[model samples]
Target: MNHRGVEFTVAKTAIPGIWQWQFRIGEETKTGKTETKIDLLAIRRVQLRIDRELKAIGQRTGPEPESGGMVAGENA
Candidate 1:
């Protein structure tokens, strides 16, 4: 699924414990052929980037992380 400039691909496999969510960044190589890869780290980074983009669009919620669960830095 693609929204605005963000392209998100969510996939599920038959393997019960295996799952993959890939982020396709449109980049052309030297040959001018558009290629795609699974950018796991970029997907994770999107949380921060998306928040900024959202706020820029007048959707302000302070600088809170886009998660509903306890983050690693929060006190348990």
Candidate 2:
């Protein structure tokens, strides 16, 4: 289930200062029909997990790749 091209949002939870990020990627079924729903809590958890994993990988790999400097005569 790729979430690309879908709409999503990030919001703060009602409890104090907790944060929650939500994503809606529609849905799918074996019969070719889908019923989309908003599982805000679940989406938030998924985002947190992904963030943790990415951070771990970045730490192990020593920062992400950077873009090279532009050429002297390059047009903008």
For TM-score, the strongest prediction is: 2
lDDT of each: 0.45, 0.47
**C-alpha root-mean-square deviation, candidate 2:** 12.7
Q: lDDT tens string, model 1, 1-76?
A: 5545656554444544333444433451111111134445434444445445545655543565677788788898
Kindly report the root-mean-square deviation of model 1 from the true structure over all alpha carbons. 14.4
Which candidate tops lDDT?
A: 2
> How do the residues 1-76 of candidate 2 rate in per-residue lDDT, one tens digit apiece?
2333434454545554455554443351111111224456545555554455556656877965567967679988
The TM-score, computed over Cα atoms with residue i paired to residue i, of candidate 2 is 0.35
RMSD, one per candidate, in order: 14.4, 12.7
lDDT of 2: 0.47
User: Candidate 2, which segments miss by more than 4 Å at Cα?
Assistant: 1-38, 64-76
Clashing pairs in 2: none
